[model samples]
Each structure stands twice: as C-alpha cells, then as structure tokens.
Target: MLPDEPRSSADPSPEGGPPGCFRHPGTATGISCTRCERPICPECMVPAAVGFQCPECVSRGHAGSRRATTRFGGGLAGDGGLVTRVLVGVNVVVWLLAAYVLTPQLGQTWSLFSAGRDVLGGPAGIADGPDQWYRLLTATFLHVEWWHIGLNMVVLLWLGPPLEEALGRLRFLALYLVAALGGSTFAFLVAGNLMNSVGASGAIFGLIGATIVLQLHNRGPLAPVMAFLVFNLVVTFSRPGVDWRAHLGGLVLGTLTAAGLMYAPREHRGPVQALVVAGALAVEAALLLIGMSLYGA
Candidate 1:
C-alpha cells in the first residue's frame, strides 16, 4: 500500500489575519497546494491536473515523473506560443526603429546583397563582403513597408505557434533561423548582385513548408495547406518586385528541416535534429562560398 502523504494545514497568522502562503507569510491566500495542502498565493500556484500545486510540489512531481512531450519530441511547454509572440514583438520593434528612428534609407543597410550600390543618394548593402554576413539573418527581420510586415507577421503568427508546439521552441527557432539564412543565400546567389532584398517572406515561407511537412508526417489533411502553398507560390511568381528566389530557398530548406525532425529515430532524435539543422547551414555556407567565388567579389 502507498504511504500516506503529509498534508500541510493552513494555520492563521499570529496577527490573527487569514492564513498566508507558506512561501510568503506576509501574503494571505485561501488557495492551497492540491497535493501537499500548503497555502499558496496566486504567484506561487501552478495549475495541475486537479487543482493548483505549490511550486515545491510541482517541482517534486516533475522530478518524480517523466515530463510529457509532443509527438515530434518537443516538450509540451511550447504550447503557450511565447516564442512566436516574442518574434512578432521583435519584428515590430525593429520595424519601428528602422522606419522612424534610423530612417528607411539607412535601414537598407541590413538588406541582403551580393554587391553594394548607391541608392537614393546613399550607399547601401553589404557589398558582398564577408564581415557583414549578419545581413542574411537581419534581413529577415527588416521590413520598411506596413503591408509587407503586416502580411508576414500574420502568417508567422498563424504558423509559428503550431510548429513551435510540435517541434519544441529551440528546434522551431533553429528551423526559422536556418530557413532565413537559406532564403538570403539563395537571394544572394540568384538575385542581381546590385539588387537588395529584405523581408521575412523567406522565413514565413519556410514556416509554410515546415507546416506542410508536419501535416504529412502526422497523417493530417493536406488539401487545405497545399492550396495555401499553391496560392502563395502563384503570387510569388506573378508579383513584380517579389523575390521568388528567397521564397523558394526558404521553402526548400524549411521542408528539409521539418522532415529531418519528424522522421528522426526515437533513440537518436536530438542529435539527428541538430545534424539536420547543421547540414542545412553547411549547404547554405557552401552555396554562398561558391556564389561569392563565381561573383568574383
């Protein structure tokens, strides 16, 4: 038989006030831990299967039991979509700084380019120099136009949360960064060296590709997602001033990254996921090197 668990009693304070939290005696609280029955204030309470548990009880329970994971090996904690919200906030902040504070022309410095040129009476772009390689990632977050950022953020908010929940936060972030790099590399290789490209469309397209792969892995319905992807592809090719190369590169790399995560062997999932992201980066680097050499920069 299981031993009886010790229960804490909610005793009144010496001052004759209502019972206070065990952790913070100065704060009165009516709620008690579900398991140990210790008094817990709102901040100290953690939602449990039944009622709230104190921080200590929750930690103990977690230590004693295996933590739950998503089907793709991601921890269930990512269900809150905190990373997605933060990404949106960061994008908005960067946009505000670039558009208003620094001036849009100056913001173009963050754009991806294999070669630099004068635009609007100002020198812009990285000039295919190795030192400013950060532009590959930064360009993903830089957007000057309202509609451009608005559309990308909406897509990111729609797709990022579910992907984060399925793949876990770190893996999801890896996928995003790698896809963004892939898109930038592709743009650098294919777009005119003097042409500058900026926006999160590539990363957003990467999310779309990852979502499609995930849906396929889970045996979920494919028609809706496929239709969405097709429509976007059409828009990509049909629209002028849109960099199709970035979208294509992001989609290809993101799909490959998700496939690696979803199909990895259960026994070696973590290492394989890491390898997949690393492989994608390696390929991007190799492509960039070859492109640079061919461009004679």
Candidate 2:
C-alpha cells in the first residue's frame, strides 16, 4: 500500500518476533503510525488530531501546510522591531562620531556636499567623481547637530515598528535605503552644487509615506497620519536650512514603494515588490547620472 493510504490491517510481526520501529530498528514496539501504519517507537511518535503519527508523516503534513505571513506578504518575525532598533542605533553612533570623535573637516566628509564644491581646498561630494558615490548613502546616517538626529530618531522609533511588522525587516530596510538614495539624488539634481545637505530626515520621511500607505491599505483612520505628514511638509518647505527636495523625493518614492508592496497580487507578491524597489533605485541612479553630466562633475 502507499505510505499515506489507510492500511486494511496491521502488519504481521517479523518472523517469530515482534515488530520493530521503522526508524529505530532495534526497538520492538506494538504501536504503528496512524497515517503510515509503520511500526513506531514512543520516541518517534508525534501527537496528532486522531492518533499518534510517525515523525515522517508529521513532517510531511507540516510541509504541506501553508505558512503564516503578514497581511502584506511579510514574515511575522519582523514584528519584534529588531531592524528598527539596529537602524536607530547605527544612526546614533554615526552622529556621535561626527559630533565628537571626528574633526570638523573630517566630519564634513560624510555629509552630502554639493556637486563640484571645494571642501577643505579639495574636490569633494558625490558629483565630484564616481569614487565618492558612497556619500549618497552615508549622508543619510551622518548628522552633526543634536536636534536633527534627535527628531529623526524619535519619528523613526514611532513609525518603524508597525511598518516593519507590516513590510518585514528586509523590505522595510530596502524601502528606507531606496528612499534615502532617492532623496539624495533629487537634492543633487535640484539644489545648487554649492549647497551641502545631511540628515536622516529623508529616510524618516520615507517611513512617514509608508505609514500613510499602510493606513490607506488597511482602510484605517487617516486623520492622525495625515496631520503628521502635513506638519512635516510645512516644516520642510518653511524651514530655511531644510532640504525640501530630499524630503519630497523620499516621500514620493516611499509612497510608490509601499503601494506596490501592499497592493501586489498574492501569487506574485515577492517578485512584484522586488521589481518596484529595483525600479525606484534604477530611476534614482539614472537621475544621478544625468545630474552629474549637467553639473560637469
């Protein structure tokens, strides 16, 4: 009989001897797997709804069962917020390094300086050369002022956990990075080459955009999130030193990323979400290249 087919009758014992467990051949036993009908020792038995099953049968059953996932196809493991805490910690450590450990000139190296700008009497910033491309990502984590990092981290702590739980750690991290790069790319393209910018505000704005998208996806109340977004946008435009381009770019990219993630077809969610992120990154890279050419960097 097939392994999973119901047995008509229990198998006879080995010639002149009791049956031994299929797994532990040395152990004699009268019990059999309810599903497979193979002789089983107590150690190899697993409790089932009707009767004990052998380990192999239980494993097969579990293998066929669907795994639990978040509403947006994310694994439930991200609910713990490990990624969020790590991001916050990294931002804080970078800020501390810039604020105290590094000299003023050295710290300026981490900021996203304007294209073709002469810093410390030398060419610096991303658009200055292809080798300095790291600044696009590094600038997001660099901060010299206490209030700048403090406000960003606070918003991150507030928005990160739920979004992480919804999108999963890997997706959430990807969105943050793509948003940060998008912000940097926009700032580079729009702001004068002489204008320098640094802060996690771009990535934080991405989180806000994600939260708003998630709220809409779940049909939840929007007032609270909308109010928060509005206030921040006001600050972005009104504040003299703020890089509104970065904020706007991050927000727009983040929103599109979150929408693609949350609205993807169930059968193709992973691939679709991946395509969305990759597309965003590609667009930003193209824009950066165009900006470089325009600035003669």
Candidate 3:
C-alpha cells in the first residue's frame, strides 16, 4: 500500500478529511460558500456571527450591505430593466413561431401575413365581418422571417433600456402601442386593403425616435444619435423586404408623441400628449377610411 498522507490539526480525522469534505482532491473543505457555492479554505473563510462564509460571500455581502434599500431604480443603469427583458422575449418568441409555422421562402402557402390578411379581409379586400377591425391591432405582432424579427429585436435591445428607465414602464409601453398602431394605420392607408405587414420595427423605431427626444431633453450629445438614426433610415429604404412607408410613418408618429410627452408644458403635458398621439393615429385611420371609400370605385 502507498504511504499514508500526512495529517494536520486542520484535517479532522486520521484520514485527514472532514465529514462533508470532498473525497477527491481539489474538493470543498467542509461547507460551501453560501453565495457562490465554492469550496473555501479555512484561511479564506470569513466568520459570520452564526457560521463561516468564503471571501467571495463576505465581499458580496459587504458590498450589498451599504447599498440603499430601494429596489425599483437600481440595476437598470448597468444593463436593462424588466420591461426590456419582456420586449426581447416577446419578439423572439413571435419570430421563432413564425419561422416554424409559416415557412415563407418555400411558397408553402403558410404565412402569418396571409392568415392575418384572410382574417381581416379576403385577398381582394372583401370584408367578411364587421369585427375584422381588430386585426389591425393583432397583426402588428406578426413577422415574416428571422432577419425581420432579428433586426427589430436588435434595435429594441439597443434602445429599450434607456427609454424604459427614462419614461417608466407605463409610458414606454404606451408609446410602443401608439407607434405600432401608427405604423399599421399607415400600411392600411397606403395599401387601401387588408394587406398584412408585421414586425416590431415600427415600435423599435419609435423607441429610437423617443430616444432622440430624450437626448434633446437632457441636453446630451447628438452626433452618435443622428448617426444611428440615419443608418437605420438608409436600411429601411435599401432593403427589399423592409417596409419603408410603415417605418417612416412610425418614426414620424413616435417623434411627435415623444416630443409631446417630454417637451410639452408640465400642467398641460397630459392633454397635449394625448392629443398628439391620438391625432397621429386618427390621421392614419382617416387616410385608410378615405382609401376604402374609393376601393370599390
């Protein structure tokens, strides 16, 4: 047999092992660090009033100990908040679902667009029922392919955190809803039929537009902001599958809405914000109604 290993007082038994210590080499000593679950040495251990903790646990606890107790506002500056996470999740899920179900490239006759179009009206714009108006809201969530959703989600990931933190969740979500409806309204107007266009770009672009106002309101640098806006605008026109009109409409609506929300007077801010958002939406709706009036002519 091999020579027995040397033992010290730190080692509990003659075998030089504690009860919970690892059987193999390079294993935990006795208890794991409560925070990171790492095996810590006695020298590295930090004594608590009740038990011992590792250095990492001591450091983490010490760091958090002096921090303010408030919960809502912290951590958003580092990365993003819950709203940003939710938007990212929603876009990703919808995109993946569309890819599996639709199979757009193979001409498989399966598409969320076509399904939404059929639901809203026949391919020829023939309305089947009065309740079809709701598709305008529902269709905004659908998209055709990976690039489509990817582009929008990338922008959302980039733009959402600052905006969500700046405006709070309710306002950020409201702006998104308005911008999305604003885009669909424009598509309905331009196509004059039940043509379905889907993607989060409109709302993503809205977030971008709102960021512009936010930067302006805060008197921050503008060159980087302008560069981002211009690049995306170019992409909107340069790509074939992209919806430039809806993008443009959403940008304009979002800019106006954000301007109203941020720059408008404090006392009248609510009413002004409402009017600007509602008016932008109404303008697009009127255009669609006017076109529909002429559709049968």
Best-performing candidate as measured by TM-score: 2
Q: Which pairs clash (backbone N, Cα, C closer than 3 Å) in model 1?
A: none
* Model 1 Cα shift for residue 43 (angstroms): 19
What TM-scores do the predictions have?
0.76, 0.86, 0.62
For candidate 3, what is the lDDT?
0.63
RMSD in angstroms, candidate 1? 7.7
Model 3 scores a TM of: 0.62
**What does the lDDT read for residue 236 in candidate 3?**
88
Residues 1-297 of candidate 3 have per-residue lDDT tens digits of 246856433345546565333223344377655666555666666777766677766777788775431122222243336677887887676666667854554222212132223233443321222244455555556666677777777778788877777665656677787787677656655654434466767777777888889888889988887899999889888988677766876787787877777775655755775676678777767755654454422
Candidate lDDT (C-alpha), each: 0.83, 0.83, 0.63
Candidate 1 residues lying further than 4 Å off, grouped into runs, are 1-64, 116-127
**Candidate 3's error at 9, in angstroms?**
63
C-alpha positional error of residue 116 in candidate 3 after TM-score superposition, expressed in Å: 15
Preferred candidate (TM-score higher): 2 or 3: 2
Range of the 10 consecutive residues with the lowest summed lDDT in candidate 2: 7-16
